[model samples]
Target: MISVKNLYHSYNKDGKYQVKDVSFEVANGEVFGFLGPSGAGKSTALNILTGLLPLQQGEVVVGGYDLKKVSNERFNKIGMSFEQSNVYSKLTAKENLDFYRKLFDVPTLDSHALLKLVGLEGKEHVKAGEFSKGMKHRLTFARSMINNPEMWFLDEPTTGLDPSIAADIKDIIKEKNKEGVTVFLTTHNMFIADELCDRVAFIVDGEIKLIDSPKNLKLQYGDKLVEVEYMEKGEVIKTTLSTVLPEDKRELQKIIEHHDIQTMHTKEATLEEIFIKVTGRGLV
Candidate 1:
């Protein structure tokens, strides 16, 4: 549903480019993530894809139309939810979605049903201005689905949300993907990306440093050792063993047989740790 090749964009002539030779593709029904820290050009890339910014260099096609030549009809197939909530403050939750439903000029789900999808069913009568931050975020997510868009663009969809709300949002995203909606998610939250994305691209300093499934990246960068923790004497003791060595297996067997085990698990690298290893910088 989306494709880009050698994409590049700059804010001003002779100024540094915000996106540099970035390239990727999002297949229909795929949950693709653009993972990066602040100042990593993630938003810049998303803006170009959504036609919010002019495409200055490289080709981008979203939903079968070239971005530079994207028409209103083509844009109607896309949905966007930004990190910052953009609902009308004075409008009630139902009123807000109703307005956008008309803007799309297409058959849409009932406003109440939309609200219910995002866990705002009974709060439909509440004015957005009176809603809490997390509630407003939920409303914004509902608004994005007003038109039942074929391609969804979510930027930090769960930012500032409590754990329960975040989980609800993630479940909604999964539900959409199950129905064949292509999702392009941009966020620095490694755990979310790992849980939801089919594949992820890691961007840093305006360049893509890595692109792979979360599981693959972890195995590629993780250590090949398992750590065993046990209670020895009056204190807890920990030891590392090579996962592939026969001697290490014997040592672990001895520990398991003689010690009161507390915990034993493989030492796997997290996405954040792998990001740091590849880019030599932490997420800001």
Candidate 2:
């Protein structure tokens, strides 16, 4: 549904690069994530796809239209939500969505229905200015669906919410993908990306460092071993396992047969740990 080749850009045409020789694709009905720390070109790349920023150095084809040649037509097929909440503060939630529904030139989906989809069902008529940060984020999420867009660009979608509220927004993104909407989501939050993105591309200093599914990357880069903690003869025993080795199996067999196993599980890398391994620090 989206394609880019050799993407390169600079905020100042003659200056340092914002994105350099980057390329990736989002398949039809797939959620693709672009992740990086601050100043990592995540937003720069997203802007190029959304037609908000011109691609001065590479080829971009979005929703089957070449970005340079057919932006006017393709713009309608794309939807966008940015880190900053973009809703009109003075308008009620229902009115905010109504305005965008007209702007997109589509028959409006019921406002309350969309509100309900984002967990704001009974608060449709509440003024957005009065809504809390998380609530405003939910309203913006509802507004993005106004056009029933073929593709969506979400940048730092869960920017200003507590854990529970952030999780609620992620759930909505999952639901959107299930309905077959192609999504190009950008964020610095690995935990969020790990949950919602089918595949993620990690970029740093205008270069892509890694691109893969969360599960595959974790398995490939993480330890393939189990660690067992148990008690034997009133003493705590901890054993490190190399799952592929015969000796580890013999040890585990003995533990299963003789000791009381309190906990036994394979060790795996978290997205945060993997990111640090790849780039040396957590997302800023």
Scored by CA lDDT, what does every candidate get?
A: 0.91, 0.85
lDDT of each residue in 1-284, candidate 2, tens digit only: 89888999998888689899998888999999998999999999999888889779888989898888854656567788878787889999999988877665545567778898888888888899999888888888777777778898998999777888787778878888899999998888888888988999989998898899999889877767888999978989988787778998888888889889989999887787788888776688
Give each prediction's root-mean-square deviation over alpha carbons: 1.5, 1.8
Worst 10-residue stretch by lDDT in candidate 2?
101-110
Whole-model alpha-carbon lDDT for candidate 1: 0.91
Across 1-284, the per-residue lDDT of candidate 1 in tens digits comes to: 89999999898846689999999988999999999998899999999999899999999999999987858887678899989998999999999998888887678879999888888989988999999999999999988888889999999999899999999999999999999999999999999999999999999988999899988998898767888999988899989998879999899889999999999989887888998998898887
Which candidate number maximizes lDDT? Answer: 1
TM-scores, each model vs. reference: 0.95, 0.93
Q: Which stretches of candidate 2 lie above 4 Å from their native place?
A: 236-239
Model 1 quality (TM-score): 0.95
Question: Any idea what lDDT model 2 has?
Answer: 0.85
State which candidate has the highest TM-score: 1
